[model samples]
Target chain A: MSPAKHPQRPGGRSARVRDAVYTAVGQLMGEGRPDRLTIPMVAQRAEVNPTSVYRRWGDIDTLLEEVSVAALTREGDEPPDTGSISGDLTQWAQIIVDDITRPQRTRYLRAMVSAREAVESCPCWEQRRGQAKDMLARGIERGEVAPTEHQVLDHVIAPLYHHVVFGLPTDRAYAERLVGDVLAMARPADKA
Target chain B: MSPAKHPQRPGGRSARVRDAVYTAVGQLMGEGRPDRLTIPMVAQRAEVNPTSVYRRWGDIDTLLEEVSVAALTREGDEPPDTGSISGDLTQWAQIIVDDITRPQRTRYLRAMVSAREAVESCPCWEQRRGQAKDMLARGIERGEVAPTEHQVLDHVIAPLYHHVVFGLPTDRAYAERLVGDVLAMARPADKA
Candidate 1:
């Protein structure tokens, strides 16, 4: 996984432990020996005391789950409001295209994807997705987009994700092409 | 990462060694420790002796590269002609949807994806993509599809990959909705 999972969220004592635990796990992952990983080992590295660590995270699986959520929830680029869904989607998707294209971020992105499948219920993923949906919603509110097509996330974003998963280029030109295809499909049936 | 990286390619002496190594790696991947994996360990497990394994594979990355090609190349589903590109695509995608949805295979699929990004060439990926492209080409030849818009893989397949990556259900109904979306996007401007 990439070193940077999420933008650090501000918090108090509990957040500090979470951050420490995050560091500990990140270091261990870098070392590359999950099989040898133990809760105590993480606790030792985090300097958080074993009992608290165990109390907070029951097992490795839960710990990883939380970490994944944290990573995905970190601050990210917001969807553009170019006053049109097509314009907004292109700009927004390009941000993601750029983000995932980064070698380091791509690793974390892939890690987050796999980690998401390991269990269930990642609020960060939901939050991220919600933002995408909101862009479509905004378009619909202005009547620039059909209400039926307001749920455009699956169409535009999914293709970008596919490129990322396959190690294919998700550059500006690629994003532009994909967005164009989607927009072509998005054109009013009578207008095309 | 997945055991069944390739369909067993028919050959002679070296093929046997490849098969043995394949089995050994498969068993290791089953235990879930690609990071901890060593060439000598694989060699011992395959009973091919360290020298031969070292001489052939040289390193874990190269060894894994070969294994991935094989796993991806493994004889699997065939894309049905189905008389129409849409029909053929629906059928073909459903097979992938089914293959990936299986709990056990999903693990291997994820591993294969991660391993894929770690290297350069993966012929198996190309092969699967070729099949998708073939469906579009066939549609164009039949004049059932626009020759100008044969590149349907990115739009259609990407959404399916999104579903697969997210561990979402890819039932027949879901497949139809996604396919319908793509078709809608594909429709000529006159047909609303």
Candidate 2:
């Protein structure tokens, strides 16, 4: 027998379930014990059948990875374009510092790192690299000399994440300093 | 009655037990499933009573932290003194990359980081800072411009660790580039 025809709906049941599961995971992560997060707990909080979550994500680690990637690389988020590379990077760095230093976000970041196996690539880092590439391209178009995206990742992003992971002070001032250091790399001989 | 006077032998029973426990932890971590590590498992591997392990270290996480710190900051280890800051940094960075990139060492590092709760001051970082300070002092005495110890940590050490934690490539060439970049920060205006 043929199935009954139905109109395709935007934000359908699947999308609604995904959003609920994501929100539940965020709440569990926000509770500051990512170690205790489990699929059943997420499913219960998400108000979906446990089988549905298991069928969708398969495991808690996969769920955490997906939620963390979404939280870290907010959809449609744009890098700051402040006319100058230094200003743009400074603002961007500050934004990162502020976001990751929050207790819940810190827990989420750490959970993501901890849950990871020996992987060749990190989606969050790749997203940041793409953003950095866009920012650098804009700076170059504006006739400003700039460090490569890798330089920005290694110098600015790496240090920030390092500090966050290691419980170091990740204040706005530290973010500004990291931005200044990377910018200084683009013009070395001027001061020497 | 007075206790019998035994010669206080260095590397005595207590030391031997600690060494065994540390070795066991290292071996378990090397197996690539840090989440499966338990005090009883470590005790069984160390051939020590589980009670003894519990009484001494209290928990697996604490034991992991101690073992990681000892392994990461080798006993009596010294930073390279290559007679120039650049050379010293390059050598030191390479040593770090080589040590931390080993599968076992990488697992140990990730275990340590994953076991951590939010707290101020990482002992391993403080030890590196001390080493960097000594290296910087020698460079200043040699009349070579040098970035501050904090700068060295933020640039070289932080990035290396960040890469290790994130499953990024951490090789000798990457280490050398990081050293070069940090040194360049010490002389910014000379390029333009």
Candidate 3:
């Protein structure tokens, strides 16, 4: 979870403090269940005082939600504009695989997932899905396929996360094959 | 979890006791994290007395392992010999979606998943995967496309568990689509 490459955020003392907090959350999550995390523990790890952490984030749940928002809002999360939805989706999926597969970041990613599950819908997750939808809309406009929501997420996105979380077959091959399957399904039915 | 189905097992006093214990484990899991489970709590819930519970199972880990074994061993879990592997899989996947969707079973299934993740590895889950492999073997023997292990589990099976655990898009249609994608992948590429 302690990655030198912080996902996003520019330089400033306030940003440093926020990065420290998010890092602490990621580190702690890597160790064990998210349910067991507490503000005091996170503050101690962040080297920030408990009072300030609470004053800013209010509670563990809120802190996690805000951090997730930061992770997804980074422009890096968007698929490259490779001129086709499937192309963009494949690249996005590969980045996701790479992101979670980083040796130091795996636990942090898992921890974030566990903690996010405990909270209401995270803004970052919602925002990511929205980005996917926007790409799909563009694909429809380009006459690639009729736009649909559930299939892409269910077939392509869901399986990737499942592999990472369950310790199943995961790697570049898994990501490529998964993208292949999604594109296979997303290709529109033949015209009469 | 505690469904009246009792899955599979001959009737007897010993069987009744085992069933009671499994039911208690499920009930307790629904209430809280599995690591937090205690013998006294299970005993109180099962009405079997703490000493007897301890004497039979030895520990929480063993008890959970045995319950999962019972679940996977149920004869009903077999994919019906519906003339083809894909036919059997679609039906089995549908049953899974329906089983988890049952109002009474939702919490029970979630509890079982929570408990399974806490133990070394879930016997029922392993057994289920084994079943998928066996069916695929039959497909290969029948001159069907050569099937590999990860594709079926990764593409076909993992998504269902992912949906259930994450509370993502879940419905009969989703399961059907998932199975369709797997079959489409499993099909011989040269056949296209």
Candidate 4:
């Protein structure tokens, strides 16, 4: 019988093992030495057998990818609805900058980037894009002239991530300025 | 005797060893497996003693830093001069996207970022800022309304690097669009 045919119950031994493994991965990533992470090391930290980690995640890259997706896309982490696109984007950008600029978060981000292989899609970026789409949809519903999701990603989100990853100075003011610049790209009707 | 008191000759054995080591580091980085790079591996690749590599560079981080700075700031690598600010920025942005989007270059960039420590400044960023300043200086001399160096960095360079690091879609058209957006921030006199 396929493993998919009998899904493990939540809070069962399987679920607890998965939770412990993910937590151990998070702790290791937090230590800021992604280069040293190995399956044996993670298994030791998680109190699980190395063969189990290998069987479940396949490899370090897949394990990292799963952990990053879980960490970045936390439940209830929706964009703010401040009644206008400008307000929403400014607040969202500030939140992003504030969260990502922390040392631990930066390390996690760098670790994720380092572990990535040459794939066409980035799950973390897709998550951010989905959030951007949610914000844009709200603004459109409110009769506000909204920038495209690509504009938000390119102008605001991309710049913020660029500054963080490259060790450039970033703060709420920088985030607000990016939001303002992208908002300026909206039609003249919005300006009027 | 202080090492600073006796600087190595430019074309001496020291310089030759340094060149060989740097080339080895670049080759290993291009191989796209930074996590496996070590002083011993680099020494083997460079045909130098591991003790010599450690004595010269101290550690992997320092060696990677020096090599990245050297590779990124190669001689005669300047932003294109297109006479007009818009043309110059558009061309420069496109060039940056083209160069950084290559698989090898992307791997090298990720390696550099992963190897970095929490420092106040980034040498590679400073190098790019210098190039941006040069482009702005030429635009000013040509009586073109020019954006500040920071503006160019935030709007154009940051976005390009962001896309590269995150595996997002980027091309010449995207680069040109960013150039246009930043150029739009110039004074109305130029717009007129």
The lDDT for every candidate, in the order shown, is: 0.65, 0.82, 0.64, 0.78
CAPRI class assigned to model 1:
acceptable
lDDT of 4 by residue, A9-78 (tens): 6666668668888999989888877664788888899988777778778888778778878876664468
- Residue B131, model 4, lDDT: 89
Instruction: Please write out the lDDT profile of model 1 over residues A104-168, one tens digit for every residue.
Output: 55565465555545555555446657776777789888987442342355565666766776676
Q: What tier of docking accuracy does candidate 4 attain?
A: medium
Candidate 2, superposed: residue stretches over 4 Å from native:
A1-9, A36-41, A44-62, A188-192, B1-9, B36-62, B188-192
Local lDDT at A4 for model 4:
26
Fraction of the true interface contacts (Cα pairs closer than 8 Å across chains) found in each model: 0.50, 0.64, 0.26, 0.59
Off by over 4 Å in 4: A1-5, A49-56, A187-192, B1-5, B36-59, B141-143, B185-192
Per-residue lDDT of candidate 2, residues A55-104 (tens digit)? 77888877887788899877457999889899989989988888898888
**Residue B44's lDDT in candidate 3:** 81
Backbone clashes in model 1, listed as residue pairs = A185-B185, A192-B189, B4-B71, B5-B70, B5-B71, B5-B72, B6-B70, B6-B71, B6-B74, B7-B74
Worst 10 contiguous positions by lDDT, candidate 4 chain A: A1-10
User: Which pairs of residues collide in model 4?
Assistant: none
lDDT of 3 by residue, B1-192 (tens): 223344235685457777788898777656544434677788788977677677677876568667656654554756766768777778777777776654334444444433333444545557777778777788778877634556666666677766665555568787788777666555444433
Q: Which ten residues in a row have the lowest lDDT in candidate 1 chain B?
A: B1-10
TM-score of candidate 2 versus the correct structure, residues matched by position: 0.85
Give the Cα error of residue A56 in candidate 1, in Å.
2.0
Best to worst by DockQ, what's the order? 2, 4, 1, 3
lDDT of 3 by residue, A45-141 (tens): 9987787678777887788767656654554655566778878777877777777555334444444444434554546546657767877888878
**Which lDDT tens digits does candidate 4 get at residues B77-132?**
77888788888788878777878888887887787667765445677777888888
